[model samples]
Structures are given as C-alpha cells and as structure tokens.
Target: MQYPIKKNSLVDETIRTIRQHIRQQTWTLNERIPSEAELVELFGIGRNTIREAIKILAYLGVLDVCQGDGTYVRAVDDFSESIVLLNRASLHDHLETRCLLEIEIARFAARRRNAEDIQNLQALLALREKINPLEDLEEFWIRDRDLHLAIAIASHNQALHATYRYFLSTSYEYTKLFIQDEDLAEPDHPAHETLVAAIISGDENQASAYARALLMPTIQQLEQLSTT
Candidate 1:
C-alpha cells in the first residue's frame, strides 16, 4: 500500500503513519512488519528514512527486529509500551528512576558547572519562565527539556549526561501525558530558581535537595494517580 509523503517532518510523519497502522490493527501482534524495501515503496521515501523509522519503533519496543529473519510487532500500543516498557516497571518506579538521576545530576552540576554552563542554565530558565503551560503545552515541554538538559550539560560527566538523555528519551511521552493532565499542576518555578541558585553557589547538598524538592510533588501526584 502506498502512503503520501508530507512536505515537513517526513520521518516523523512516516513513523506516525506506521504507528497508526499498528494501533488500528492493520497488522496483528507478533506478525512480521513489511520489509524495508516494501516500506520504502509504501511510504515513497528513501531506504534510510524507512530504516530510521523502523529503528525508532524497535527501540520503543513496538517492534522486534531479528537479523536474518524479520521485524515483528511486539506491542500494539506505543504509548502504553513506552511508559511500562517490556520489563513491566510500575509508574512509581519510573518516577523514582528520574528522581535518582536528577538528584545526582544536580549535585555534579553544582560541583562542576562553569561560567558558560551557568549562562546556559539562566537562559533556559528565562525561556521556561515565558512559556505558559496552559496556553502551549508543547512549547512548555520543549523548554522544560532544554532546562533539564542544560543542567545535565553542567554536570560535566559525559557518561552521566548520555544516560540522563537516554532516560529522558524513553520517558518523554509519559512525561508529556502527565503534564497535560488537567489535575496535574505546573512546575514550581520558584523551586527551579532555588535549584539554579544552589548550583550557582556551588552547594552540592543544597542543589540535590532542591532537585528532589522539584520532583517530589509530581512523584506524589503520580503515585496518587496510579492508585485511583
């Protein structure tokens, strides 16, 4: 089957179309997905685009690619698989994982942050402050991501920074959904300011505490949501 290519974000559009097909049960669970050549022909895109889309799906556990064999459907729902993953961690587990990484990131950032890192953090915070979460959730999220990534960059530990990004990528959709919940409140801007202050002052303990403070309310809310 042929699919029309859009003018913008071709790879994203392609991925969305393929994901839609899976969700609509165009293909059954455990069924082999169309071959790369077939997908390239179907989507009217290059082989590399098809490969990238397929790789993203496989990474998200929606598809299982076996070399010398073929790619098969692993899950019908991308969002569900994203939050729970194949390992079946609880929602609280996911929140705790984020909390653990971020707290240490704050501490390292406090110890290692340089002048440029501070400037980046301040700029990201300024951008974040201007965003109205109720008005533009997507932009709010993007700024939020930038702010956290700025902190990670301040950490000056390449391995830690990379791991933090990996976790953020996997949890991105879930975090987006959580923030969009009407019952969920916006992030505490004052807490962020305080966290930045601690980092600027090079106070590792205070920075860690502020980071935990920033994350705790959301964690409590998630815990409450899970039970209800």
Candidate 2:
C-alpha cells in the first residue's frame, strides 16, 4: 500500500499512484478502497495531501467519495475508460442521446420549474453569457453544461436528472469536438436566453423548440464532418 514519495509534487504523485492502483485492480469496481486515515497511513503522507488527491480523483469519476462513508472505486482505469467511451459510442450517438433527453427535459422544466429553479437558470444563463469563449472556451463549455444541468434538475424527475448527468459526463469529450475556436469567436447563443424565457413563462412547446434549436447547428456540422 506504501508508494515511493517523489517529494516535490506530493499531491500529484499521490494522485498518479492512486490511479495506478485502480488501473491495476488493486482496488476493484464499486468496492470501498480505504478510509482517509488509512490512506494517509498507507501512503505515508499527510492527511491533507491524501484528501486533496482523493478530491481530484473523485472529480475525475475515478473514485466516489460519500459523506461519512468510505471512498469507492467508480472506475478502474482512466485511459481504459476513455478508450471504452470512444469505442462504445460515436459523437453522433452522443448528440442523438442529448436530443432525446433534452427535448423532454425542456418540456418538463417548463411545466415544473418553480421560482427558485427559474432564478437559478436565469443566473446561470447570465453567468454563461459573460464568459467570452474566445478567451476561455473550456470554461464556457463547463458553464453551459451547468446551465443545462440546472434545467434538467428543474424537471423534478430524480431518475431523469441523474441519467442526464451521467450521459453528460460521458459525452463531454465528444461535445468539445462540436465547436472550434473560429466557431465560438462570435458565439451568438441567443437561443439560450429565449430558452430560459420560455421555461420561465411555462411555455413547453417553445421551450422544446428552443432546446432543439440550440443543438441543431451542431448536429448539422457533425453531419457535414462525418460526410467529409
């Protein structure tokens, strides 16, 4: 359980070693790996370092940290996970899945959204617009995802919300391919504003239309790319 210390980059080294163990099946899927205290002792590192490393891995979906419960192995290997994601579905597949989920999500959000959900969606929309994608494209994408996630949460369907989040995480890498720097330079995403307005006004049909509108261009470009 002990790993050789690299001294300078304790946190990064710990993270790499933990991932190595997971990849090697030293920790198996769905199994609770170890407690924070045990990991600190096993790694011979400070608790803070171990905690930080675990935090990063949890964010990456390699580990799942439950409050009061031990961290569990959510995935076996990062590289193999990415390979499987690549092989299991194409970008077009991810987009089609998005369309299927989002249309209903928008419809239900429009029907179910309360004051708080509307406030949150509006706030996220404003925050998303402020980000100049030309300067920070990745951050813009994250914010955009957060907004869509908020809309899904507004649907009041826990299963649908969880499923959408799972698919969103899986499709994230492929979603990045749908836009380029030049494409994002101007970034005319006015449909987002209207979509929020539609949800706020409880207009289900309009909300669905705007949701599909937001994605249609990307789908078309993907089609163009696949052809070429």
Candidate 3:
C-alpha cells in the first residue's frame, strides 16, 4: 500500500514514517533505491514529492544520493539531526512548551546530576552575567538559549535534549523575554545556575521549587502581553 505523507507537513512525522519503513527492513540503508521512477510508483506520489522526501532523509545523514546514481538509505535510526526541518507550529507555542518541559525535566535532573554539570552551569551563568544589552539582542538571546540547553543536556536525557531544541528554534518569546525588560539586561538569578545547582546538589525538590519560581514570572509577563 502507498503511504500518504503526513498533513500539516511536519517533517518529524514524515521522517518518522520513513524511518519506520527502514527499521522494518522495508528499505535497506546499504542497498540501492528502486529509482525515482520506482519511488513514484511505490508511493504513488509525484516526482517532486519523492525528491523532497529523499532530500529530507539525505539532509538527516540517513541517505546517500550520488549524481546519476540512485538514492540509497545510509542510516535510519533517530531524526534529531533534522529538528530544524520544521514546518508546523509558531514561536510562542514553542516557548510555552519549552518552559513546560524544563519545569518537568528540572525535577528529575536536579536529583541525577554530577559535579561537572554544576561547573558548566556556573560557567554559563558567568557568561550570561557579562551580557551587556548595549549590544544587540540577538547575541544575548543566543547565550540565553545556550545556558538553558546546557542545563537540559546535563540531565543526560536524549529525549529531553531533542525536545528542548525543538522549542529553541521556534521560541520568539524566549528571545523577547530579556529585551522586553530593558532594565534587566542580564538574568538576575540565572535560572540555569539554580537549576543545575539543585540538580547537582541532589535536591530534586529544590529544583522544582526554583523552576516554578523562575517560570511563574515569565508566565505573568506573557499573560500581560497577551492582554495588552
């Protein structure tokens, strides 16, 4: 049966389906593809659709397509390499989800981390402190995301890492959070410091408490923005 592409055009879903086929041995990474013409017949799709799909997989390092030689699957495991291949959702939604994810992940992470994680957390916080809003907001925003991601990665959970990036790419509010507060150039508490500290110090309860304390203010700010 010809499989239909996912609606909403989410590449994650599309890649997931394609990866499933590869995992089921429906497609072999080391073997040659049946050809563009064959893909058209196999999926009952147009040439461009097949081409784009193949390109997506290729971009994920999951396929190899030599000029004049047919496409072949190279790997078919995870698609975390392709989070940037998004077409669905908005920045606000992404920020909302990201904040929520940290709220949960921080709880478990605070209890499961080590000394190195704490060190990295402190370093990121120091870097954030050096941020002068007299410069462009973009650079500051990048550092902010880096610090949060550093803490999330310290959790050592692959799924959380992947999900965290998904939000990072789409969160406009995250970028806006600092710039909106002109007086507060650098983060006062450095949310990641508190997060990483609690995690590395084996205080799961403190991590969650701090996370709520941290995000609750952002939530209020967002609500104010929405109303105004």
The lDDT, on a scale of 0 to 1, for candidate 3 is 0.69
Clash pairs detected, candidate 3: 110-199
TM-score of 2: 0.59
List ranges where model 3 is wrong by over 4 Å. 1-88, 134-136, 169-174, 181-187, 190-193, 224-228
For residue 226, model 3's alpha carbon misses the true position, in angstroms, by 3.9
Writing each residue's lDDT as its tens digit, candidate 1 over 22-131 gives 88888789999889998888878889888888899888888999998999999876654454462365556777788899999999999999999999999999999998
List RMSD in Å for every model shown: 10.4, 8.7, 6.9
lDDT of the candidates, in the order given: 0.84, 0.83, 0.69
- Please report the candidate that would top TM-score against the real structure: 1
TM-scores across all candidates?
0.60, 0.59, 0.57
- Residue 52's lDDT within candidate 1 is 89
> Which digits, one per residue and each the tens of the lDDT, describe model 2 over residues 1-228?
476657789998898888888878889899999888888878888999999999988888889999988899998656545656644887667776788789899999999999999899989999999987657878988998899999999999999999888778776566566655245212266878988899999999999998887777767776787899
- Once fitted onto the true fold, the runs of candidate 1 whose alpha carbons sit more than 4 angstroms away are 1-91, 225-228
Ranking by lDDT: 1, 2, 3
Q: Residue-wise lDDT of candidate 3 within 73-145, one digit each (tens)?
A: 8986645644544335343344455557887778767766677777877787778767764476677777777
How much lDDT does candidate 1 score? 0.84
